[model samples]
Target chain A: MPPFKDLFKGKQKYVTVKPTSIQTEQPDGLWTKCTQCGQLTYTRELAHNLLVCHKCGFHFKLSAAQRLAITLDEGSFVEFDSNLVSADPIEFPGYAAKLEKTRQATGLEEAVVTGQGTIGGYPVMIGVMDFSFIGASMGSVVGEKVARLFERATRQHVPVVMFCASGGARMQEGVLSLMQMAKTSAACARLSEAGVLYVSVLTNPTTAGVLASFASLGDIIIAEPGALVGFTGQRVIEETIRQKLPPGFQSAEFVLEHGMIDMIVERRDMKKTLASLLALHERRHEAG
Target chain B: MINLTLDFEKPLVELEKRIEELRNFSREKEIDLSEEIATLEKKAEMLRREIFDNLTPWQRVQIARHPRRPTTLDYIGLIFDDFIELHGDRVFRDDGAIVGGIASLGGRPVTVVGTQKGRDTKENLARNFGMPHPEGYRKALRLMKQAEKFHRPVVSFVDVVGAYPGVEAEERGQGQIIARNIEQISRLATCIVVVITGEGGSGGALAIGVGDRLLMLENAYFSVISPEGCAAILWKDGSRAQEAADVLKLTAPDMKRLGIVDEVLPEPLGAAHKDREGMARIIKDALIRSIDELSGIPPRRLVERRYVRLRRIGEFMIREAAQEGFAEAASAGGDVLRATGPAGPKGEAKR
Candidate 1:
């Protein structure tokens, strides 16, 4: 073969490719687009980076399965309550259809996946919420699973770890959704009374009813680097206050400054951070 | 206080006005009009019943938000003795939206906490329109904890439009504070009696709302989200609040039917605003009865009962039967399986 430089100089046929065309032409699942920065990344590379944006560091939302696969020790998770699904207590209009469609799309029985798992050799009763399933809103099934997780952890004297990602309570279930806050909180109280450790990890867009319940009741609350964590939505706050919010209002960094969370851990270091914290608590418990 | 009136109450108000006018005319003319007045009075009573007896959920919502409705302070003034108002969360400023204190209910010492709304513009501003912040919940939590230590039962009156949706509220960790209150209140050694006096709005109300016995006024509404909010989200039109209200199942009777509330105390004709003292008297009796019943249970049992009561509030179904049913339905080319009544052997959905 001729020299590469010589070939390029002799027959320079430049084909200009537009970035938008490149994005559109690629197969759908091959590239993951960063929601915050609009940066295109190879899907496999992004997955390898724990779904954090390679360029902008935006933490993409994860499904409960993905969360379990990354956070738990390989093949260590034994799922719990995979059979529980929602019932329309009030017979909300169109709710059944919506639930059916969401279940079909996500293949999740409910918004939350609860299980007993080993995270870096420390066994924990864990529950991870998938926001894709109805915004991971705490309805009847979600509440029961979480309450059972805490109850089981209390009984077993095992530490519990929960990954919370929700918009709020499910509106379709009406006040039944609201009562889940109390249900989950009561379970959390029992866990605390039993003196079993509970660590809550908040992911992107944790707000409203879930935040006001067990998600906020964690003994040690950890947040992803850029998670939107707060009691109310930003638009609702702006409408109520009749003013613009300052930059970084409900971001993880802002919440840290306000002393709401224990720490902000990046996705890359989340497993290590969680393992260390669990080890510390275990050591302390043994010493005590 | 501004005399706010609902559209449905217009005919009742006009009838009352006519009755007053007739009395004035009889006095002015010095004529015997007793027979005519009695007939008119009977007509008015019928009209009142016809109007108030069949109130729609939307109408009750209006009553719950009525400016002239009895407030927390009004109930406190009428129902309790020696109501000394407590102040502050000690972590932050005292929230005027929520008021808490120690008082005697039928001669028994109890802790009282409530979300307070104001009668006028300035007072409403001071009260933040009864929407609490983190500090408000913290203050309620502090008082409840005190109640636990002192062995006094806790009585919380819920009448809020939800926690304040504001920046400072979030910055101060509103969610965490509310969560802490619910957790702490659930395990408080003292009995808790929460009354939904007016608008029991979402987690704001539930922050201090978990208790052994929950009583609600006939016209009061306890909702997950406001009708307006629900309407706006579901139908994309806030004006469809009436439909949302009808669907929310938030009225006292609805809650009672759902097994969420222990009792639905009747309101006076024309709702609580018409006879504040009468409404307070009704609530007083309910509180005394609830406190007495809850007080009989030991502290540990009280906590356990609370846990069980709360644990039973959700509705869901098991997937094994559902999946099997789905398989059958799919094979038969029929509809998806529907839950009959939250049936499961695990007792997770026991009513």
Candidate 2:
């Protein structure tokens, strides 16, 4: 058999730019390069445009705080289960150290932050995944937080809005991380049965286990423009198939053509879209 | 018989090879070496049986992924009759990774679906190495629902590492399709028999895995993630897969013991690859028997039983101290929380 490296020699086609902590830290007075277009723009200008590239319309990854600040009504967010953190039951080597480092680097308790917030003054449950927090991988904590968020939302009679931005299951927790896909999915199943509206906003790079779970179970699914949403990595698929991928295979536009997502809303218009949806659902609930 | 022999089966392969060499030499020389050849054959057979009987979890995983192993289509051809394959997820193009159709298993009509990995490189590419996309899953669900409507039993052969992890698959609601399949399959008004034919990895496997009676081939493995994925996550090294396999308890025997699988259908002599016909017979008999047994029950009861079966898997005892600590904390906070006003903590109404 040929060497493994020989099979995938020149197949790394997609250029994924890993956003640094420094780029996300201040969000002002700095120049950031658009991963898709390679055009640099002032950070303050990017923030004013909701971190979307002015030139090529590329959507940058958002932190959980930034997502909540933009989507939710002012000062209306009430977080739930904030203290829940993974205990690393498998005792994975360097897992504790890595979690500590990520915590310090991102200033977040876990990859996902779940809470109750008002979207256009309509009660809704929100769970936002921060891509900067260890690639926003779903571990037990992320799963539990999302599950509990849905449970609370169901009891309180509110719609759910989740911003999905993940790089699959967290590896540190091993099988525990994988099980989260099922656990969170089961919770979403219950929420669906309860007749609660779930609007899943697929941000840049939502793939693997999370994509297979609650992220896909939305009543009204939306995505940011040019966001990469898929289960397998592009490079892995190319290597396995030994073929060239079509242009924009995993992008939001490609997904829309495939009829996976309902619509692609720009970052600046995301709040308006979500608010309109919330109001529409509120009217339905009142009449029904 | 195949050239793809595993590490543990090296001795058996070598002995078999020697026996073949002696047979060829005897035929060429026109000499009487039949007695010696017979003795060597007996020894080889014994060695093969012994080695197969004591396989470790990692070895079973290897056998499950063996290139020569009979795949879903192979089993369908051998065991079932009139397999008319249905294609395409109505909303999108058909996915070749997962194949399903109406077929007759032992003269009983059933809807059959399974992940199809390729034998050669070309076929593997076409089938996406049996890692299904959202359309693949949606296709399976559609066929299952069709079976449900027709009051036919459903039998799915599982052999996938997981769902496809591509950007297109995710955009197409891969997770939602799989999760919905699980939810809908559980409540389907028909007997469902799931046969774990090969690698049953994670949610990808479980997407089409729900059934009243779950059967597994002796060498088949089912786990949340592949051993390599687990090793990479835990040890930061993919080489620790063997250790991960041992700890994951993903082998058929382990699954049977853990109540994840109803029965373990024993493979012939050296494993499924050595005797595809024999393996097919065993699987066919198991599926027919399980379906017959399940057919007598009402649809509601079968659905309830399936729910219980899934809920019971991976159930374990949490640490007593942790349980008590959590309960105590909850009780301590419950009173104060109840005493608070109707207004929420952040000044929002409680609704």
Docking class of 2: incorrect
Clashing pairs in model 1?
none
Per-structure clash totals for the candidates: 0, 7
**Once superposed on the true structure, which residue ranges of model 2 sit more than 4 Å away at CA?**
A1-58, A87-97, A100-107, A172-179, A241-248, A283-288, B20-46, B54-58, B77-97, B104-108, B118-135, B161-183, B201-204, B223-250, B253-263, B292-351
RMSD of each: 10.0, 8.5
RMSD versus native structure for model 2? 8.5
The residue-by-residue lDDT of candidate 2 on A1-288, one tens digit each, is 112222223321223233566557654335556656777666556666766668877676666766777777766777777777767655656667877887776567778888787878888889998776766888778887888888887787789999997777765555556556666766676677788899999987776677777788888889898777776656556655678787777778877887788999998898889999888888352554
How high is the DockQ of candidate 2? Answer: 0.11
Task: List where candidate 1 sits over 4 angstroms from the true fold.
Answer: A1-29, A283-288, B1-3, B321-351
Model 1 Cα lDDT, one tens digit per residue, B316-351: 888674333221222221011111110011100000
- By lDDT, the best candidate is 1
**lDDT of model 1, residue B65:** 95
